[model samples]
Target chain A: EAGVAQSPRYKIIEKRQSVAFWCNPISGHATLYWYQQILGQGPKLLIQFQNNGVVDDSQLPKDRFSAERLKGVDSTLKIQPAKLEDSAVYLCASSSRTFGYHQETQYFGPGTRLLVL
Target chain B: SQKIEQNSEALNIQEGKTATLTCNYTNYSPAYLQWYRQDPGRGPVFLLLIRENEKEKRKERLKVTFDTTLKQSLFHITASQPADSATYLCALPTGNNRKLIWGLGTSLAVNP
Candidate 1:
């Protein structure tokens, strides 16, 4: 079984520019998540999806960040008019269980390292 | 406000020794806590999970202890090796138990 896959291992953009990252989760996984991990800090959840439906996105910056899991297998996270504070690693993870199921182990992909100049 | 904290400084240990790391939290009663290992520039990999009801759990050379009363968890790697050098993270469930609140992580270096 393959683990979660992400594209563009690293990215650099200027402030106010737009950037997007992609994620392909493990096969048969029903839940996907996007997290932002700043240097020297733990990952902060940005959004979570269960079978194409959003389960939680309360921490997402609605004004600048957005994410979608269109077909339930792959997802994308976008940030527009990016700020210097947005320079962090964006991680994509997936789990085999449905949302609300506790004790599920999440498999993570090699995150995309984004730098905003 | 709820908060999770780990040792901010890196820990250095010799091979064959035991490495112990701590995770402390405040204002939250998580049902369970998780531990993960992350290499530089890579996402974290799941390592262990200990519940509030369980005092201790072990996997191979790794051991985890959870104390709900103290709101703390301890992760230990026994017979450590140089390959164990990495950042170890601890996470607790949020109020809803649907998401996790994470700690900054403690970097560990096992010297040969």
Candidate 2:
């Protein structure tokens, strides 16, 4: 089976510019997640989606970041007015299980490396 | 505040040796702990999961031990190879079991 797919493996943008990353999760996977991983640090959950509804997005920067999983399939994460601190890798993951139960193994994408100058 | 920690220093070992990495946490009671391998520029890949009720879990050459009382976990890679060199991360489920709290991974390098 195909793994999670991400577009534009890398991106470079200037501060205050807007950027968007896309993710296509494993087929039939019901849960999708977006995470930000800074250099030498673990991934931080930005948002999670169960079907088309959001499960959790407490870590997300509502003023500058937004994500959507439309029709419960493809998802996208956008960061507007980017800052230097936002120059981290954005990862997309999926799991076969739904939220609210025990956590399941998550399959991750290659991730999109963003460099904001 | 809840926190998870891993060795910040990289572990270097010779091939054919066993590599053991540690993960410690405080102020949280997780139902399960997970380990993942991440290569440079790539997302983490799940390795193993050990529940709070389980003492240890193994898969092939990889072994994981969880101690809820101590609030720590150890990940072992036996007969290590150069291919096993990567950053190993530990994660625990949040209180709601709906999210995960992650640790800054420990890098391991198996020399030939």
Candidate 3:
């Protein structure tokens, strides 16, 4: 089986510009997530989606960040008017809750490395 | 908010020795704790998960222990080899949320 897939493994853009990253989750996975990781920090959850609807986006910057998982299989994260602080790797992950297993293991994609100058 | 901490320094050990990494957390009691391995320029891969009620879980040469009262987890790799070098991370889901918060990760280097 294929793992979670991401597009434009690396991206470079200037501040105030807009950028977008895509994620294709593993087949049959019901949960998709987006996270941000700085140079020396762990990945921070930005948003999560269960099927086509968002599960949580409390950490997403409403003003500049937006994400959507239409039809529940693919997801896209967009940042408009990017700031220098936005320079970080954006990671996508997916997970599924199977019977008898209360916890699920998430599978991550290669991630998109964003450099905002 | 739940916070996680892992030693930032790289652990250096002989190839045949056992490598142990620590992960500590505060302000949370997670149902399960997970361990992941990541290399430079790559995403993390799942290694193991231990639940709160469980004391330990093992697979192959990897073993994970969770102590809820201490709010910590320890991951051990036995008969370590050079190929075992990588950053190890621990993650736990926040209260009632499916999203997991992560630790900065501990780098492990098994020397030959």
Candidate 4:
């Protein structure tokens, strides 16, 4: 089976410009997530979706960041007025289990590397 | 606020020696802890998972031990090989599926 897939493996834009990254999760996975991994830091959860509906987005910088998983399949993360500090890898992951499973292990995509100048 | 810390210093070890990395957290009660291996320019690949109720879990040469009281987890790679070199990340779930709090990964270098 194919793993999670992400497009535009990389992106470069000006600080004030807007950029978007795309992710296509593994087939049959019901949970999708977007995470921001700053340099030298662990990934911080930006948002999570369960079948196209948001489940959590507490750490997301709502002022400039937004994401959506429409049709409960592919998803996208957008940043408007990007900041230099936004340069990092944007990872997308999916998990395929429900309430009965002990724990859902997420499968991650290669990630989109964004550089803001 | 919940915080997770891993040894920021890269671990260097001989190819044949055993390698161990540690993950510690504070101010959170995680239901499960996970380990992932990330190579340069690639996303992390799941390695192991240990739940709060479980003390240990092993997969191939990898072993993970979790101590809820200490809010710590240790990852061990026995009879390590140079191919085992990579950054190892530890993560914990906070109340929901896939909403993980991660620790800056521990880089390992197994020299042949």
**Top model number, DockQ:** 2
Across residues A37-88, which tens digit of lDDT does each residue of candidate 4 receive?
A: 8877788889999899999998899999999889999999999989999999
Better of 3 and 4 by lDDT: 3
Candidate 3 has which clashing residue pairs, if any? none
* Candidate 4 C-alpha lDDT tens digits along B1-112: 8889999999999988999999999998888899999998888899998989999999999999999999899999999999999999998877745467789999999999
Clashing pairs in 4: none
Q: Pick the candidate with the highest lDDT.
A: 2
Q: Residues A1-117, candidate 2: write the lDDT tens digits.
A: 999999879999999999999999999999999999999999999999998999999999999999999999999999998999999999999998954659699999999999999
Q: For model 2, what TM-score is found for chain B?
A: 0.97
Question: Where does the lowest 10-residue lDDT sum fall in candidate 1 chain A?
Answer: A97-106
lDDT, residue B6, candidate 1: 99
CAPRI-style grade of the A/B interface in model 1: medium
Worst lDDT run of 10 residues, candidate 2 chain B, spans B92-101
What does DockQ give for each predicted structure?
0.79, 0.83, 0.81, 0.74
Clash count, predicted structure 2: 0
Q: All models: lDDT? A: 0.93, 0.94, 0.92, 0.91
iRMSD value for model 3:
1.0
Task: Put down candidate 1 lDDT per residue, A1-117, tens digits, no spaces.
Answer: 888999999999999999999999999999899999999999999998988999889999999999999988999999998999999999999988855657778899999999999
**Residue-level lDDT for A16 in candidate 3:** 99
In model 2, which runs have C-alpha deviations exceeding 4 angstroms?
Answer: A98-101
Question: Model 1, stretches more than 4 Å misplaced?
Answer: A98-101
| DockQ ranking, high to low | 2, 3, 1, 4
**Ten consecutive residues with minimal summed lDDT in candidate 2 chain A?**
A95-104
